[model samples]
Each structure stands twice: as structure tokens, then as C-alpha cells.
Target chain A: MDAYEDLQQATLHDIPRSECLQLLGVARVGRIVFADDEGPVALPVNFRMDGESVLFRVSPASEMCLRLNEAKVSFQVDRLDDFHQTGWSVLVRGTSSYVESEDLPVLRSTRPLPWARGFRPVYVRVQPTQISGRRLVDD
Target chain B: MDAYEDLQQATLHDIPRSECLQLLGVARVGRIVFADDEGPVALPVNFRMDGESVLFRVSPASEMCLRLNEAKVSFQVDRLDDFHQTGWSVLVRGTSSYVESEDLPVLRSTRPLPWARGFRPVYVRVQPTQISGRRLVDD
Candidate 1:
């Protein structure tokens, strides 16, 4: 029971994972970050949350996807408006994998696809380990 | 002058590095991506641009800040709206390094600080490699 208690305490103190998915649902475009031996890279991706995971596509020969799926990855999605001084963000850490075409249909209806060419859209999915989020509550 | 001509040709085909600053000048918040051994991560940051680099801050111990600045980094400033389905994005690939207090003046005055906080905001500069960008012109 001690380990269970500790896990509960940590999860309680941290931002809820569900909030991260909620924020992702509201945002259609956000940047994805990847870290590899070469260094850290951030790129803009049009994404939609699939269940608890994140799904997005890029052109073939994508440098970001190539690195992300090959390593433990983290994706940060945030939206902020300077004028309003209000915004929210969500970050997910996990391993990324390529989403096969056979699995696309279940995701397509809910996922907001980018305007970029889709005929060969290479999809990448990030399965989360820990998810956290923050937001500036509007007055 | 053949080398210069070749360079000029490359610039013509790609977005000029200087133009990045120009586009940044008109924007206030940008998405920042970082990675640390982990794959990729992205988040929105309230930032401004220097001549060839972009600057933003994070709180002490912030995951985004720590994971980034470890080595080669990439930050992107982009805008997308569903209605028009068109927007421009600037991706900066550079080493993420801290700007100490002594150097703040030079970095601060390069552009107005749109994002600040009571907590000591760690300043980071992203020097870019390729600054190519595209938009959905007719979408």
C-alpha cells in the first residue's frame, strides 16, 4: 500500500493527464519536439488526439518523424494569445511509433488533418508515459 | 563569384535568414520545440527575435527549458487558422544557449519583452540553420 500511496500522491500533485487530451482536442495545430544524439528539434505539426495518444502526419523522408519514432519522445502542444495574455499547454512524454494505414480509419474521423498533401501523409503516434498541462485561467 | 552566385541561388530557392527576423517582428508568441535524449517536444512560447536567433524564457526547473539548450535545438514560430487554412511558419535550428544577466541588455533591446515573469525567466537563444517556410497559399 505504500507504493500505491506514493503514486497517488505524485499523480495528485501533478497536472492531470486527461487535461492534456482536452487541450489537444481544442488545438488542431501545435509543435512536436524530438531529442536525439544530434540534439533537440521542434517542428510544427497539425495534430489530433486519438484516444490518449497523439497522431500527426508529415511528408515522407521527414527528419522529425524519423528521429521521434526511433527514440523516446515528448510532444508539447500549446496555444497562447499575447493580446489576451491567456493560454494553455500540454506536454506528453513517451515512445513514438508509426501508425499503420489499416489503423487510419478509426482515427480519421476525429483527427484534424493538416492541409498539407495527404496522399502520402506519414503518420506518427506518440504513446504517453506521463502527461501534464498548465493554463492561465481567464478572469 | 561563382560561389557567391551559387549561394544566391540557394537563397532564392529558400527563405532568407534575415526574413525570419522580419516575420518574427510582426509576431508575439511562437511555438518552441526541444528534445533531450528523448525524441521531440514542442510548446508555445511568448518570444521575440534577435538578428539571427529567437529568444524566449522558462521558469527555473521547467522541463521545456532543461530538455532544450542541451545541444542542437529547433524553435518554430508559426500561425494557423482554420477558416483560411493558410499561415506562415519560421523554424529556427540552432544551439540553445542561455543569456546571462550581463548579456540581457543586448538581447532584451533587440526586441521588446512580451513575455516575462516574477520567477527568474531563463533566456535562451536559438541560432538557425535552414529557415525554410511555406504556407497554404490557395487552401
Candidate 2:
């Protein structure tokens, strides 16, 4: 409605897969989205990129460990600037499953460390079938 | 594994609905989780708490405008402290519908302003069927 509002206008751009992966690799925290009996749920998790998949840990007794195995899920990471009103978000759609027992040793040494206090021994990996991202910037 | 790791142990607590609503009222940004044709997706949006509902605006042509109307969705808002490893997250699960036209004038004056440049004329409101939250604090 005013000149400042015009200045606040932004353009949205599609980020390529490679760039999306790069962003994911650098970000340490993201929201993992999945459905429960009620509906969709999004919860934050500390994550690390393992090749093209996302690797994180949850408590073996947690609902995530119980419901996420082999389920279609989405992982979202973003950097938002409230002052500048600019940001980018990447979404990874994939199937989540427990990491194989054989890979635990190496992954334990190299994967993301959970920030929560309790033991998060069950490692889950989301193998993305589709990765997409978008960026919003001043026009 | 170490003394510092032991110090980093956090305790998780269930926050009551009153506290969750209080937190939601003060937060300006959140992720909306909904299912598309592919699966679950979480996208960041600037939103406001409307009574017990969540209100946000999106482009009429956007997928959110099309898929979110009359759809069951979840809106999640959180505050994370990477340094202290403490945070709280609140989730609202409910059905979304376009804000009725008659109430637009008054609602528009008090609603959350979208940061992105573009016309966001379609106002969507998610009326919560359930609200839950949790907090992680240093033990």
C-alpha cells in the first residue's frame, strides 16, 4: 500500500538439488515432519547429511523410533531473517528407516550428536526421494 | 561420554495447554505441516494466533491455498537454544479453512503481516482440535 511495502516485495526462486544439498549439509538443526494417528507433526531434531540422506537419532523408546521406520516423511531446514524478511527453506521428502546395525560404529563416530540429555541410540535415516528448496529475496 | 556431555543433559517436560497458547501468541513464525500428493511437507510461514486458531495468508495460486483449505494440518512453533541446549516447541493440530469474507476487514487490521513480497489475499485459519507442547531444560 506504500513505498516501503513496495520495497519489501520479494522474488521467490527455486533452488537446485545440488544447492539444496549444500545447504542441508551446513545446517545442523531441522524439523522432521511425519504423520501420527491424529495428523501431521513437525518436530525439531539435530541432523547431519549422510550423502543424500539425512541421519539423526531418537530415543529408542520415543514415538519417532516407533512410528518413523519405513514411513514417508519430510525434513525441513531453513534460515530466516526476520529483520530483512529474507530466507531460504529446503524440504526433503523421503522414506525413514533405522540405520543398519553394521553402519552404527562409523556413524556413531561421524554422525550428528543429539543435543538432548537422554540417550538417543536409535539412529534413523531419511533417504530422500525428492529434494526441493526455495529462496525469497528482495526483488 | 565426558563431563561436559553430562552437564549438557536436559530434562524434557510437558507444557500445559495454557502455556502453549501463551507461547504461540508471542511467536511470529512457525512451520505448517500438511500432506500434498507426495507426502508430508513442512513450510515456514509467518503466522498469528487467533484465539485458539492459527492464521496466515498465502497466495491464491499457491499450493498451500489450494491444499490447505478444509484440510487437517499442524502448525508448529518453537524456540531453540543451540548454546544452552534448551528449548520449547508447541504444536497445534486442526482443520484449516479460509477466513470468512465478512470478518476480513477487522481481522486484516490485526493479523500477522507476511514478510514475503506478493499479494497474499487468501487468509487461512487452522482451528485446533488439539494443542500440545514440550520443553527441554538443563537438568
Candidate 3:
């Protein structure tokens, strides 16, 4: 409808799994979506990529932690360009669980630090069953 | 554990509904969480606040549209400050439905335009059943 219609056409592209993992590795934040009593909820959390898994820390008393054990969850990370209105979003669908205490030290060193300070000793990890991504860009 | 532990404490504050709506009005991007066959999928969508509901356009053939009629959805908008580790998140849980043909004209004028190019004539609206928000900030 406008002059830049040609340039504004957002061509969608499917990103390969390798590239999806690469993007997830570089991202410092993502949203974890899981089913709750009411319905579904999404909350942002600082996360780190460990091998093929996504790891994050949460307070034991936090609502997010309470709802996340062995739950089927989706972790989403996206970068948006407001100026151009082009962006890429990666969605990882997996089952989430608490990381074993024996592996806490390794995870502590490798995990991205949480920006919000609290007693976030409980570690949660999502073992991805599927990883897919799409990019919207000017053709 | 760090020197700014005092400054790093995250204070939780409840954001009033009026302020939450104001914040939603300015946001250009938000994530829409809906029930998918695999699990709950959170996809980023550009949306606008219309009265007390959230509205956005989508292609009728898109997967998002397929799952959206009278479905329970959670639309989330949040802003994060990486430097200061402070931010606010608002979650709106509601029933979603396709916009009535008779109301499309008014919605077209008031709703935020989609960034993608297409015949996105299908308009979806989420009327909130419950709206709540919280702020995470350095105390």
C-alpha cells in the first residue's frame, strides 16, 4: 500500500538447526513458556546454552520454579529491529527439569548470570526436542 | 555475594492497570502464547491495544490463526534494561476471537499495522479476563 512495498515485503526464511543453536548461544535472554493452572504463561529469564540444552537459574520460592518441573515447555529467543521491522525468532520445544545438584558447580561456571539478584540457587534446564527458527526480512 | 548486593536486591512491585495499559500502548512488539499441538508456543507479534483488548492481523492460513478462535491465550509485553537489570512485565490472559467483519473498519483504523506484507485480512482480538503486571527493580 505504500512506496516501499517492494522493500517492505517481509520474506520469511527457515533457519537451519545449526544456525538456530548458534543464535541461542549468543543470546543472553529468552522467554520460557509453560502451561499454568489458568492457561499458558511466558516469562523472560536470563539463560545459557549448555551443549544442546538451555540452562537458567530461578529462586526456589519463585512462581516460575514451582511450575517448571518436568513440564513440556517452549523457550523462545528473538532479536527485533524496530527501525526496519525485521527480526529472527527461534523456538525450542522441550521438557524442563531441575538440574542435578552434582552438576551445579559446572553449570554455575558456564551459565549466564541472572541480572536480578535473589536466592536463585535452583537450576533449571530444558532439553530441546525440537529447534526451529524463522527470520522476517526485506526481500 | 557481591559488593552491590544491597543495590542488587530485586524489589517486586505491582503495576496498576492504568499504567499497564499505557505501557502496552507504546510497545511495538509482544509475544503471544497459545496452545499448540507440541506444547505452548510463544511467537512474537506486533500488536496494539484497542480499548481493553489486544488486536493484531494475521494471514488466515497461518498456524497462529488456526489456533486462535475462542482460545485461551496469554499476551505478554515487557521491557528489560540489561545494564541496570531492571524491568517490568505485563501478562494478559484472555479469550481470543476473530474480529467481526462489521467491526473490521474501526479496528483497521485503530490497530497497529503489521510489518509483514501479505493479505493479512484476518484480525484477531484478545479480550482480557485477568490482567496483572509486576516490576523487577534494584531496591
Note the Cα lDDT for every prediction shown.
Answer: 0.64, 0.85, 0.84
Chain A of candidate 1 gets a TM-score of 0.75
Each candidate's TM vs. the true structure?
Answer: 0.75, 0.91, 0.90
lDDT digits (tens) for residues B1-139 of candidate 2: 4334555578889999999999998888899999988778999998887788898889998987889978989999988876776789998999989997675446454676788878887889999999999998777
lDDT by residue for model 3 (A53-130), tens: 999888999788998999999999998777788999999999999998776546345765677766777789999999
Chain A TM-scores of all predicted models: 0.75, 0.92, 0.91
* Each candidate: chain B TM-score: 0.74, 0.91, 0.89
lDDT of 1 by residue, A33-122 (tens): 776566666666668778788888766665665676556777777766677656777888887888877776463456446555433357
Clashing pairs for model 3 are none
lDDT of 2 by residue, A7-47 (tens): 55767889999999999988888989998887788999988
> Model 3's CAPRI class?
medium
> Model 1, retained fraction of real contacts?
0.54
Interface RMSD in Å per candidate, to 1 decimal?
11.3, 2.0, 2.4
Model 3 TM:
0.90
Residue B48 C-alpha lDDT in model 2: 82
**Best candidate, lDDT:** 2
The DockQ of predicted model 1 stands at: 0.26
Ten residues in sequence with the least summed lDDT for candidate 1 chain B: B3-12
**Candidate 3 off by > 4 Å:** A1-7, A105-107, B1-10, B105-107
| Superposition error at A49 for model 1 (Å) | 2.2
